[model samples]
Target: MSERVADSTIKGFLYQFNKTILEIVNADDEDVITVEGVVEDVDVLSASGELEAIQCKYHETKEKFIPSLIFKPLLQMAEAYDRNPSARIKYTIFIYVPNEDHCQKDIDPSILNSALATTDQSLSKIVSRISGKFDKVEFLKNTRIVFGPSLDEIECSTKAALELLGIQGSDVDTLLYPNSIEKIAKLSSIKDETERQITKAKLYTYLSSATHTAISKWTLALRNRSEILKNIKQQLSSYFSQNSRDRYFYIDKNEIDDYEEKVVVFFGNYIKKYYSKPSHVTAPTFIINDNIEAIRDLEFRLYTKGIKANTGLVGNSFVVDHFFRDPMKKINRNHIEEREFDLRLLAMDSEQEAINHRKGDDLYLVCSNTPNNIELTDVNFYQVGISSFNELEYVIGIRNSHE
Candidate 1:
């Protein structure tokens, strides 16, 4: 497993490093923004009318080297600039070696220079390849590469810059600050409630039209009793023939009726001991009744859990009317026969949380709300709610049994 550390620690280091570099470049006029997390090695962007990309690597040893690292990021930077011709970007690669003593003893300075020269050549080759294939207006130009000075030199330069800016050591210390444990504690507290709200929204949307289909199936099954019984008998016969005992004791119909009575009594006793009152009805009777109750009960449970019913509001209305309605209508058709049902619920909010209540799949965050106000029907329930995006604590309650 990879070593785990606080994200704030990483961010704090990057902030200080960026602060130090901006001072060294004397690019005070340029905007310095810390681009967090996404890119592999790149840390900060210094851009005025032109753009410069910087990659920071903090390594204790050679084993920490991330291979062929600069090639792709350089290509991406070049492409980013090409897309926006008006805003050109100049690329700079900074490899910070804080522990200078660990630097390979036999490695020649000239060879290091040659490797950088080769990387520069490779970057130009990449730009040429892209330009040849596509009609993009911007191609990389005026790109520069710099190897940061020794750690002592970097620290001295940074301290000098701090002094020049009239920043005290305490001020520098403040910039490297990490998030408090209390802040994390507060976030953890709300995380569960947020997850529950998200789950409720998801269940509401899924159960909206699909609940009708499940009810309709039960109703149809009751109406066509002969056909349904025939299918059930065939299924049960197949199951029992493979699993039941081969030897059969001869018994009269009266004895068979008596055995069934005792079996029912035993089942009732078992139910009374362990199961809830609603779950204790006769087996075949409960199967039909439970299907109807499940649909109604699910809606009630969702409401009680804090999800609102479909009120035909514009934001939440589209998903219920368009996406779920059609699929549910088809579910009533004759040929639809499946053991499991899969449904998607679009959250009432514009954000559109997607809550997927599958039999065994881990509940996960699939998508975030995008800027485009497009009507989304197939979104998971968790994506739409007010609380779901915060953190995934309540997802534990939304298991197969709960669904």
Candidate 2:
């Protein structure tokens, strides 16, 4: 038996981190804007050529306002103002901490007042105390700090944003952040349920330990703004496809061609041996099961090859269960044939017509990695294909182990 790892505290923090971003994007009096830069944690570019840069900090255990924590963001804001002389760019230090008392009473007012300070001496003294940097009252005037949105505020803003953006889903926890959604989409490409669960678990464990510090230190290096913006736009554009029918069990596109190659090699040889193939016959193309559209194409090819393949789940659930429990145990010469006969006798026919097409003496093909070997009496009525994902893993494992 294997020991399961404990979930980390940072998982909750990541959730809160995204919610904070959503809140900032749809802040009151601000139209939802395209994030324009990679310099700040959250950069909102308004239509009127104004910029609102927001730095998000989530410290749940900290009781007091940390001065040193605000320094880098403040310095960045000062530099940003210098870079863009014409644009009315503003900076906001958005803090989300568990200690609401100090934030609500002291930090909020102090930040606003310091930003509006008329005298250079007062602003410089405050800046020197916090960041060891001084001068530039004009830059300080455009900067502000405030406590981040509360849970309730986040909830309200999320609902409004979803509606405004025409997104429909009952999942409350799904943040409207582009990077988060992209991560989910990437994970969806893993076809095996067990692999997906294990991979996500490892990812969460890694994220919990390392992601927070990395995110805080992100501004140390800046990526190309256009490329970052393009990626973000592309991800946001794919929101409609986030609920794709086979998203959870789809094969990754990168593996699709290789899977087709393997299928051609494996099944083409089977066809040549079992059924006579003319010299004029070309290599049969395979459609991955994960592709709903390509599955139809596969059926057409199979039909042309004098083999009709049915992948529907009408009467498959029972057979699937039977296979998992007793794949090698043959109750009858034709298990599917016996079941169909019983169903017809009882007048309990399946609504789906796909399963009725194949009958007795025909080999049942299951796409799974189970029952390493199978045997049946007279004509050997069973056949199963190793899942493409597992086959790929096996091939890779063998090659690596050989070296």
Candidate 3:
């Protein structure tokens, strides 16, 4: 594709991503958001169990609403309808035509029918596309065509929705916006449809814990930096104090070029402090985002430092298991299978491992940079504050106060 075409295509996906986030942010606690679901783009399963199927369309060069623009999308909806005619699914066509006066917020079925009768995509063709089945009146009744906000507007709506949910202030844009997008993108990108979905409870758990992100230093900025790291040091005291059960560190992939070194130092400091205390705490489960390779690389470094990890790579080969297990036995000083985690640093290959490994505290400290937020119901929860990793080092006793 041409550069401009590719850019437009990407922009279209961005619109869909932003729109999906808005639906999730505005949804009720029980609602679920599914990407690339029943319809082409996005779907929201409401608290009442009703499904709202959405198809988002954007044309930067277009001047007005074209009824034909929604025809194919409606056909996709029609096809879905044919699959289960009685399914309680609400079809939505979210479109944007540059001139507001020339577009519509709600589609007029009569106009839509008249357009279909004239356009090359006649009603009969739609039926054939859906294997000789289609709905006219019923489809229009269940279908909704509304004007979608621009990408920027949708992002603003996302921020606004977050504020309504109790997280507000300048950080909403600086930290929360792109961070939330990164999250939704991750969920939406998952290969499994079942895994490519999130509910309000899950999103809320992630949002509530993002306060630390508003202050931390990293390079994965979304918008222009006006005051991103502005006055960052002032907020360091509140970041992660050594005593808090929850500590979070935000490290966007590629955010730091020399992150392995930085992350090692950070993890090393926190690990020692966490285990050194009188509590039988053995180790801290390092929560990484979507990068397992980074986790493996990190394990090698930790092992070299006499600190080994239980990265899931074990069982792949004896060499793999031994490389990690030997050092862990020497450094962690406890059997990997020991259930006593209060004072035992544990090894984890995945988030599930940490969950299964926890013995005492139903709530344990999980530290990471933009951790893949798990549903609290699935076995996780968190809270934290920190301006910079250096500040975190000091608060967690990794760095001396005298320094």
Candidate 4:
């Protein structure tokens, strides 16, 4: 990884450790609140006002047990201790030494002790080389060396930390959920220790409510509303300034931070509203693969509950009673003639049943069975007529003729 990416990853791990493991374990201590962007990678303030500063070091390969490798952190610790003698601070050097293969293994404490005792270029030699500012005692009394955790440990701890923060059940799934990615990206900003804690607390509050709502809204759009999904994809493509010809766009976590606020707005003002519970009507029942019995039961329930039935079928409905229910209609006046004609044919079996089923409402049926042409006809009670059917053969013929 690049230095910037590596540092960012380390910083993320430290933040997780502070929030998830440290905070939860010290919940009652109150005094042991963590401070970030301060003297150390992880700083904890105790009840007596003393500070525990932990510095984390990461290496792609096992860190060499030598004075040059360990002297810088020791020097930083000496500086911090000198400035905070009254605060009685202790410094910890946490080293994450991964192998060349990128797998972490524990380091032997003796290796660190031996490095300090090296004769020619030892810790003492390094300290002497640094203008005699700090001695071996300062390094020994004020600082302790420790090893960092494995990659697996981080993942397990992350899961535990999220749970400790009350992100349980479905919210747990939201951790990897796509819509929640933008919210996570919004937290990428660097801030002082206090503001960081407060911001995360506020985020937790939002996740508790927004995660479920976002998930539900996404599910509704994917399952029932193709047009909504298409619009969302279009919006994303436009936002990213990608090829308009692209039919679908994948969301990346890195890019999410940039447009997260816009996503929040889209979800709040548009997507949620589109999928919100219908006040005047209930949810539409979609009969998958033309399940007759399911449609019959749904129609019966709608009749018994006196709920306006909003139903869509993918295939043919052989039963005439299915037609009697309210038909999906184009409400504009321009469609009124076509709408009336459809109502007439649907109610042809029994005008009284159709009238009774419609219950004095103008309802039209939306079907995929396109006849060659629709014939306008007048009939008793409701207009009923049948016309010849053709495939794209007639449409192609017309297009060719015009050409």
- Full-model lDDT for every candidate: 0.30, 0.37, 0.57, 0.38
**Number of the candidate with higher TM-score, 2 or 4:** 4
Each prediction's RMSD to truth: 22.6, 19.8, 9.5, 21.7
TM-score of each: 0.29, 0.36, 0.53, 0.40
Task: Write the residue-wise lDDT of candidate 4 on 62-122 in tens digits.
Answer: 4544444655666556556555555577777766555423233333445444554556443
Pitting candidate 1 against candidate 2, the one with the higher lDDT is 2
Best by TM-score: 3
Q: Top lDDT: which candidate number? A: 3
* Lowest lDDT block of 10, candidate 2: 339-348
How does model 2 fare in lDDT? Answer: 0.37
Ranking by TM-score: 3, 4, 2, 1
* Cα displacement (Å) at residue 286, model 3: 19
Query: Per-residue lDDT tens digits of candidate 1, residues 265-323?
Result: 32233223322122221111010011222323433443554332222124423433333
- lDDT accuracy of residue 101 in candidate 4: 37
**Per-residue alpha-carbon lDDT of candidate 2 for residues 1-403, written as tens digits (9 for 90 to 100):** 2221111233233434444345443554434332223445455555576767776565555676666555555655655566664567777777665655424222343453444342556455544443324336665667777776544454455446544543343222322332332233333344543332222233333333321111010111112222333332333333212222110011232333356555434443433432222221221112232343455454455556555343332452424222112112213443321111110110112222222322223222333221222222332121122234333222212122211
Global lDDT of model 4: 0.38
